[model samples]
Structure formats: structure tokens, C-alpha cells
Target: MTETLADFRRRVADFLAHHGCPAGAAPSRSRRPADHVAAARVHQRALADAGLAGITWPVEVGGLGLGPEYRQAFAEESAGFETFSAVFTIGLGMCGPVLLALGTADQRSRYLPPLLRADEVWCQLFSEPGAGSDLAGLTTTAVPDDDGGWRIRGQKVWTTYAHHSDRALLLARTDPGKAKHRGITMFVLDMTAPGVTVRPLRQATGDAEFNEVFLDDVRVGPDDVVGAVDEGWRAATLMLMNERVALADNPIGSPVTLDAVVALANRTGRTTDPVVRKAVADAYVAQQQAELFARRIAGEVRVGRDPGALASIGKLAAGRLATQVSALALEVAGPDAVAWDPADPDGGLWAYGELYAPSLSIAGGTEQIQRTVLGERVLGLPREPQADRDVPFRELRRG
Candidate 1:
């Protein structure tokens, strides 16, 4: 029997009320990464037990095998409450989707169940020292071993939560003799393997939410390869598309809302200023616009349609909106935002949001990258001329 949307919404709301963290219950940004991960695992296990997690995944992998609309409904219902989803965002939203789309049957069966229940965590190993914006130009190398496996050696920077991840979807150059993009391969890397090192990178927000990873001849079995060898670009493209959508639909990390910003304005007596009022109004409208666009993109995915460039649009809007809302909150916070009393622990929320705002634009995909995708992919514009597009990666100049 198919459950109606209203019934699903009620079920989600009831579950969240019992198990969800109330909005503003804690300063999420101030929480340690390990603390967040621990709480999220607990929350996810409970949600999975109640058939709320993996709302759109297949039944064979312990999901309810529901439609995408159910997932969308859950997102809408759970938006106001902190579901502790940040820790598993890369696993569930990005890696899980990629595995589902291109993974072998064995890979899907082995990984998806644990991921849905938050029994494991995942991260992405795509951004390298040389491949932040130009991911295809990465220098990471995976050499074939005598055991029919591979040994990876490279560095990946800005890896979110690598310190705690159980696995990661890694991209490396398997055939540098081919063109940069054509030579790449994706693998499911075991984070606990030998020669793998994770070093946390403390951001300006005083949070170690990102990390830089080093792989010193880390061994990966043939079973760990995702998609076909030397053809990972297709799988990578799918993941990136899903990443933009996920970043849009799910505010994975600690996100500040307009309501909180407005309340700060009211408390600080800034609401009376004409300029402040106008900025608040503008922020509200922008929030609505971004939300509506996200919903539209979700609808397309619900029907099994690829969002493609539309995901980029939502991502761009979300990135801009994060900065706009957080900046407004900081402005309203005035002196307290800069230096709050030590006794008042929550007083620095606005400051944290302000510092975290810049990363929102930079993460997932940059504003400039998103715009380039939109212009070239959506508007049917001419492709950017890369002088090294057809050149072999081994022969390319290094920084």
C-alpha cells in the first residue's frame, strides 16, 4: 500500500518531534566534529530503525524503497529541526548516491546498508593541492600492483571529516598517458588502511570541519574500484551533479536561518532602522527564492530526471544566500558579534555564522565554477579553451 504524502509528512514530523534536535537547541558550529558525529550516528540509527532514513533507497539495502517524493517530504518536515545529518551528509547525500547510480551490485549491497544506518561514515577525496577548481587536472597517481590491485599516492585537501570517515570515494590518475580527464579513475578508499593520514585543518570559524589527507602508497583492491577503470569521469560527473543538488536540498552543516537573524535584529533594537528593515526584507525574499528553486530541482529528481545545470543554479543561490543571511545577522549583532562575554556561551553564534559564511561559497563548488557550468552547459555557450585539454597529464607542467 502506498502512503499518501500527508501521511508521510505526519510520520516524519512525529518522528522528528520525538528524536530531532529542536531548532536553536545548541550552537552547532561551536560543537566539536567528533561530538557532532557521535550525535548524528545516534540520531541516524534511530531514524533508520523507524524507517525514516534512506527514504528513497532500495529495499534490498534496508531502505523502505519509497519514492523520491517521500525523501522530499522528509526534507521539508525536517528542515526546521536539526536531524544531526551533517556527519553523514557526504556518505548519504554524495557517496551513497554515486554508488547507487554506478556501483556494482556487490558494492551497493555491502556499503549502502551500513551507510543508511550510520554504522559507517564516508568522505570525498577529489580536491587535491593542484585540483581544487580544476579537479581533472589532479596529479594523484594509482599504479597497478602485482596483486592486481592498485597503490595510490597523492594529497587531498579540504576533505570534510576525513579523520572520522570509514571510507572515501577517491579519484586518481590511472593512465597519465591519456588526457587529464580521460586518465582518471574512481575508487572506494578504506580510510583505515595503511599509509593513509588525515590532518585536520582548522578554519577561521574555530571549527576543524575540514582536513588535508595524505596517501602514501595506500593499497586498494580491485573490488574497491567504482565504475570502470579509466572511465571514472562519468561516475565523477554524476557525483558532482548529485553533490550540487545535495548541497542545495540539504543544508548539511550548521546553517543560520533568517528567523534567527530577524530575532537578533529585534533584540538589538536594529529593527527600527529603515536600512536594517529593508535588508531583512531583502534577505527574507532571497530565502524564499532559493527555497522555491531548490524544491523545483527536487521535483525534477523525484521524477528520475537529471537536474544537470539546474543544480548549479540552486547551489549558486544557496551559496549567495548563506553569505547574505549570515552577514545580516552579524551586522545586527553589533559589538557582541566581535567580543562576547565568556559567561554567555551562545553569544557568539552570529560571529560564528559570519566566519562560516565564506566557506559556503567555496565548498561543494565555488560561485565562479557554478556560473561557468551554467553559462557553458545551460546557455549552450562556447566551452572554455583549455590549452592542456588534450595534453597527457605526465607531460603537463607542475606548479
Candidate 2:
């Protein structure tokens, strides 16, 4: 007999309790980056062992092969518990889906199982110094080697969790003779390769969660290519759309809750302040709107409907809400948001949230890019004028 949703929820709840944390418990935010990675792997392994991970993916790729309703049920049941799956966000959210959609059968058989179990962490290596917003203009080059493989030489910046990742999904120019977006190819790169270097970029939060990766004559077998050569733009676009959808939940796991901020306002004696009260109310409403928008998109996708560019709407809304909520938290905390006692980890969390808030608007495509996508694709607006739209990558002038 098929299991009911209530039974599935109870099973998940029992697993979560036995695994590490119980429901309504907060995630440990003060752990070091490496510690977080270790905990994520352990928790993800437990979920995989319990058959709770990859709820909607194919069973052939180490998933449960269940419908999207099961996935949604799992999300609802696990809402309050701390799963520590954020470390695997890029792998499961973006890379794994792209591989399933455009990868070879062998590639899926080799990569997806370890990914589902967190046996190997993955990151995205698409952004470069010159191509943050204009990803298609990336100058990274991957040339065919004499050994029927490829040699990649380029740099990627703003790579999340790269230092802890075992693999990465890379985009590089395979044919500079073609137009900027035409000659690209996607590859699965081993992060521990001989010519790969990862340097962490310290954020204002005093953490090195992001990195700059340098590749020099990195060798990749022909089988590592994700999709057709000189046609990576299509694969990249799909990955990006998936990324925006993933960002709707704020996968970084630091959600700014209204209750927590309200408690802060009461503690700081700002509850009576009209200005602060109004701002808090506005932030709360925005948060609810963002959540509803995300749920709407998720509902459409769950039923096998294509949200298309509508995915960008949720991402844009959530990013802005993050910034607004964090700023309001700062107002509520007053001076405490800027300077907190070093011994108290919880005291510094809101401060950290404020610092991390700006990145939400920047990552997974910038706010401006999201607007442009919505404008052109969803609103049927005219395309932005680009003089070099048809120019070959090599012919375009570089700064």
C-alpha cells in the first residue's frame, strides 16, 4: 500500500530526531565553514540513508522517484528543523539538475549518486572577473588537447564554498571564433586537479564563504563535457534559471524572521517608536509576499508546468526582501547591530545578516539582470540594445 502524507511526515520527523536535531530547533550558525561542511555531509548522508533526500529525482540517480507532492510534504515537515543542507545547495540545486537535463547517461550514473549523498560537494564556476552580470562574455578558454581531451585556463571569482567542494560545473569558451554566447561549453571539473587553485575571499562578516578559483592548463577528459560542444549557452541558461528558483528559498539558510526581529525591537525598547514599528510592519508584509510568490512558482513547477521567466520574479522579490528585513533588524538593534560582544555568538548574528544581505541582491544574477529578464521575457518588453550582441568573442574589445 502507498504511504499517506501524514505517515511520511512522521517518518521524516522521527528520522530528523534520531539523526541530530528535533523540530523547531535552530541551526548552528556559529560553526566554522569547514565544520559546517562536515555537518552537512553527515546530515545529508542520514537523509539519503533514510530515503528522504532527492525526493523528486529519478531513482536511477539515487533519488526516491516520488512525485513533487512528496517533495513539498518533505519541505513542509522539515521546515523548522536544522538540516545543514546549505553546503550542498549549489550541487543539488543547480549542478545536479543541469546534469540530469543535459548530461550524458554515463555522467549521470557517475555523478548524481555521490552528489545526493553529499559524498562529494560541488560548486558553480561560471562567474569571472569580467563576466559577473554578462556571463556570456566570459573569457575563459578551453582548447582541445592533443590527447583527445581539453585544456582549460581561466579564472572564476565569487565561487561559493569552492574551498570545500570536490567538483564544479564550469563554463568556458571552446570556440572564440564564434559569437560571444555561441562557442561556450560546459564541463564537470575536478576541484583537486593538478592545475586548480582556490583562494577564499573574506566577506564583511569575517568569513571566507566565497572564493576566487584559478585554472591553468587543467586537463579534462572528453567524457566530462556536460553537453554538446559550442552550445554551452543553452545549458548555462537552464542552470541559471534553476539557480533563480533555488534562491527563492534563500538557500543560504539565514532567513530573517519577523518574530525574532520583533523580539529584538521589544528588547531594544524601540517597540513604541512609530517609525521603527512602521518599517517592521512593511518588512513583514514584504516577507510574506515573497514567500507567497515563491510558493506560487513552486506549485506550478510541482505540477509539471514551466514557470519560465516567472522564476526570476520570486528571486528578485526574495533578494529585495532579504535586504529590507536585514536593514530593519539593524534599526531594531540600534547600535548593537554594529558592535556586539565577542563572547556572545547570537549577539553577532543580526550583524552578520546585515553584512550578508547585500550579496542576495548580487548573487544568482543581479537585481538589474533579474529585472531585465522579467521585463523582456515576461512583460514582452523590447530587448536591451547590445552593440556586440553578434560580435565574435575574440573580436570584442576588452578592458
Task: Give the TM-scores of the predictions, in the order they appear.
Answer: 0.93, 0.93
Full-model lDDT for every candidate: 0.84, 0.83
The segments of candidate 2 whose C-alpha lies over 4 angstroms from its true place after superposition are 1-7, 20-31, 249-255
How well is each residue in 1-399 modelled by candidate 1, as lDDT tens digits?
Answer: 877899989998999888888766633535756776777788889999988878788889888788877877887788768765567668998899999989999999999999998889999999998898888988889999998899999999999889888999999999999988899899999999999999999899888978999999999998989999999888899888777666656644335789888877877778789989999989999999988887787777767677888788877787788889888877788778789888896777888878888886788778898889899989989998878878888899877
How close to the true structure is residue 17 of candidate 1, measured as C-alpha lDDT? 81
Error of 1 at 142 (Å): 0.9
In model 1, the worst 10-residue window by lDDT is: 246-255
Best by lDDT: 1
The segments of candidate 1 whose C-alpha lies over 4 angstroms from its true place after superposition are 1-10, 26-29, 252-254
10-33: candidate 2 lDDT, tens digit per residue: 888788678855533434434466
- In Å, residue 201's CA in model 2 sits off its true spot by 0.6
